[model samples]
Target: DACETRVPLVLCGNKVDLRDCGGRRGGVASEAGERLARDTGATYFETSCKNGDGVVDALIQLARQMVTTEDVAVQTSALRVCAADQKRPCCGGGGRKDV
Candidate 1:
C-alpha cells in the first residue's frame, strides 16, 4: 500500500540548524520538506537534532495516533472474528461459512 493510504505518517526534515553555518543557500530545505508532505498526504516537521527543535512534538503526535488507532483496529478485528464464529447454517442460504 502507498504511504498516503496509511492512517498516520510523519515527515521530518533533519539538520535545519546547519543551513546557516554550512552556508547553504535559499529556504529549499523547508520548502522541499513541505512539498513532500503535501504530495504524500502526511504531516511535516522541520527539526534540528542538535537543538531538538520540533522533535518531541512531532514524535508525540505520531505516537498518540498510533496508540489510538491500533486499539480501534484490534477491537474491530475481534468483533469480526466473533461474528464469523457465530454463523449458523440456518442464518443464510446454502450454509456457506462466514468469512
Candidate 2:
C-alpha cells in the first residue's frame, strides 16, 4: 500500500571557510542560513570542503533523522515481513514433499 511520508530536510551552506579568507566577505551569514532553515523546517549546517568542517556532522545528523523517521521505520518493518514471507515454501511445503 502506498503511504505518505514527511522526509527530513537539511540546508547546507558550503565553503564556509571562504567566509574567513583575507577578511573578505563570502556567502550568506550563518544567521541567514538558520533563519531559512527555520522557515523551511529543516536542519541547517555549514560545511567547508577545504577544511572538512561540519561535513561529517551534517551527514550524521541526516542519517539520524532518516533512521528515526516514522515512515522509514514502518516501511522497513513491512519489507522485512515481506521478505520473510517470500522465504516460505509454496503450498505450505518445504522443498519437494514426498507423496
Candidate 3:
C-alpha cells in the first residue's frame, strides 16, 4: 500500500560515518535525494548509523506530528458529532456538555 501511495515520504540517508572513513563521501547523493523529496513534497534526513545522529530527533518529530494530527482528527470528529446531536431533538439535550 505504501509503495503504491507516493505521499508524505521520508528519505533518510544513513551510515554517514562510514562514508568518509571508507573513502566514500557522505551525502554525495543528498542533492538527488533532496530533489526527489522536493518533487514529492516529502521530508529528507541525513543520519549516521554509528553515532546515531539526527535519529531520535527525526523520530520524535514524526511522532509529534502524528499525535498532533490524530488529536486534530479526534477533535474534528467530536465537533461534528456534537453539531449533529444538537440538530436532533431526541438525542439528549441540545446544550453543550461540561467537560
Model 1 clashing residue pairs (backbone)? none
Best model number under lDDT: 2
Q: Candidate 2: misplaced stretches above 4 Å?
A: 1-4, 70-99
When summed lDDT is taken over every stretch of 10 residues in candidate 2, the lowest stretch is 1-10
Q: Where's the lowest-lDDT run of ten residues in candidate 3? A: 1-10
Residue-wise C-alpha lDDT for candidate 3, range 1-99, written one tens digit per residue: 224332334667777676677676665367777887688776777777679987886677667766766676677779989998778866475676889
Residue-by-residue lDDT tens digits, candidate 1, 21-66 = 7576533388889999999877899887789998998999899878
Model 2, position 97: C-alpha lDDT score:
50
Error of 1 at 43 (Å): 1.3
Best by TM-score: 1
Query: What does candidate 1 score on TM?
Result: 0.67
For model 3, the local distance difference test gives: 0.69
- Write model 2 residue lDDT over 3-81, tens digit each, in one string: 6556788888888888978988876689999999999989999988788998899999998888789667687789989
